[model samples]
Target: MTTPLTSTQQAILAYALEHTDGRIEWFPASLKGGARKKVLYSLCRHALIQPSGDNWQITPAGYEAMGRPCPAQKSVPAKPHTRQNSKQAQVIAMLSMPEGTTIPQICIATGWQAHSVRGMLSGVFKKKLGLTIVSVKTDAGDRSYRIA
Candidate 1:
C-alpha cells in the first residue's frame, strides 16, 4: 500500500523530480539540511526518490504525481538500487580510466581484493551504469575494458 506523504515530503519529491536527469539529480543543500531529515527519509522510504551513486531521482510515485507515466512500473516500484559507497566510486573511476587498467592493477591501486574488483565490474558498473565489460587476450592475458 502507498503511504501518504506529508506536504514537506511532497515538496521534496517535487523538487527532486523536477531536477533528475539520467545520471544525476542535484538537491540544494540549503534546503535539505538537518531540519529536513524526516522529509528526506519519508521520500526515500516510500521509493519516491531513489539514491543514485552520488545523487537521487524521482521514482514512480514521483513521476506519477507529476502527471507523467512512470517508466517501466507495473505496480509498486522496484526498490531503489543502493548508491555506490566511496570504495565503489573509486572502482568505477579507475575502471573508467582511459588506459583501462586490469582487475589485478585495480586491486593493487585501490587495496581491494580480486573479488571486490570483480564485484565492481559486474555488480555496479554493469547493472547500474549499463556498461559492458571489454577485454583483449594479449600474449600475457586478458586486459582492459571500454564502454561497450
Candidate 2:
C-alpha cells in the first residue's frame, strides 16, 4: 500500500510531468517560496521526482502515480564536441578535455572574466543544456571542471 499525495503535490507533479516527453523544466511561477519548497520536498521524498543536473525529472513511480505510461528508456549518447567558433563553444571544448579545464584556462581561451565563465557554467551548461559538471580541486590547489 502507498500513501496518497496531497493536492499541492499532485499539482506540482502534474505540471512537471506535462513538460517535454518526461523531464520537467518550468516550475510554475505561481508556486513561491515555502509553499513551493514543501511540495518539491514531498515529491522528492516519495521518489516521484529526481534531480537531473539543475532540473527535476519525473521518475517511473511518478508516472505510475499520474496514471501515465513511462516513456521508453533510451541510451543517451556521449555529448558531442562543440566545433563552433563561438566563445561559449570554445569554453565547452576546453572543459571536455581529459584533464578538464581550469577557470583561468577558460578565461584565457574565451577572453571572459571569471564571473562570466562561472555564469556560463552554471546558467547555460547546467540549466539550459542539462549538462552535469563536476568540479575538483587538484593537489596544486587549482580547481578543474569537466562534464560528468
Candidate 3:
C-alpha cells in the first residue's frame, strides 16, 4: 500500500525534488532541525526519500508527489546510520559485559548523562528498536538492560 506524505513531508519532498541535480542545503531559518527529521522519517518510511551519506534526496515517489520529472539515475542523499553515535549500540555493548553493568556504567561508556541514558533506554527499548531490557541482581544495584 502507498502512504501519503504529510504537508511537512511534502514540503521536504518538494524541496529535495527541486534540486535533484544539485545539493540541497537547509538550515534552521529554512527548516527547523526537528521538523526536518520528522519529514525525513516520513519520506523514508514510504520509500520517497533515501539518505546519501549525510544528505537527503528525493525518491521516485517523492518526485511524483512533487509533479517533477525523475532522473535517469534515481537516487537520494541519506545520512548514514552509524553505531559510533548510536545510543542503542552503546547500551547494547555495555549490557553485554559479564559484570552486568548499571545505568551508571552505560552513561560512562557512552559519555551520556545518567538522565539521558535512562531516557534513551526507556524510549528506544521495546518501542522504536523493538528491544527489551532485563534486570539482573548485582551487588552494586539492580542492573537493568537488554541482552541481545
Among these predicted structures, which one has the highest TM-score? 2
Per-residue error at 104 for model 3, in Å?
Answer: 65
Q: Is candidate 1 or candidate 2 better by TM-score?
A: 2
Instruction: Judge candidate 3 at residue 109 and give its lDDT.
Output: 75
- lDDT by residue for model 2 (17-126), tens: 67566566555678788987777788789898888988778899998988888988898998867668888788878888888999999988888899999999999999
lDDT string, candidate 3, 18-76, tens digits: 55452344423566767777766766777777777788666676677667777787478
lDDT per model, in order? 0.66, 0.83, 0.66
Pairing residues by index, what is the TM-score of model 1?
0.38
lDDT preference between candidates 1 and 2, better one: 2
Question: Which candidate would rank higher by TM-score, 2 or 3?
Answer: 2
Model 3: number of backbone collisions: 7
Q: Determine the backbone clash count of candidate 1.
A: 0
Query: Which regions of candidate 3 fall more than 4 Å away from where they truly are?
Result: 20-24, 27-30, 74-148
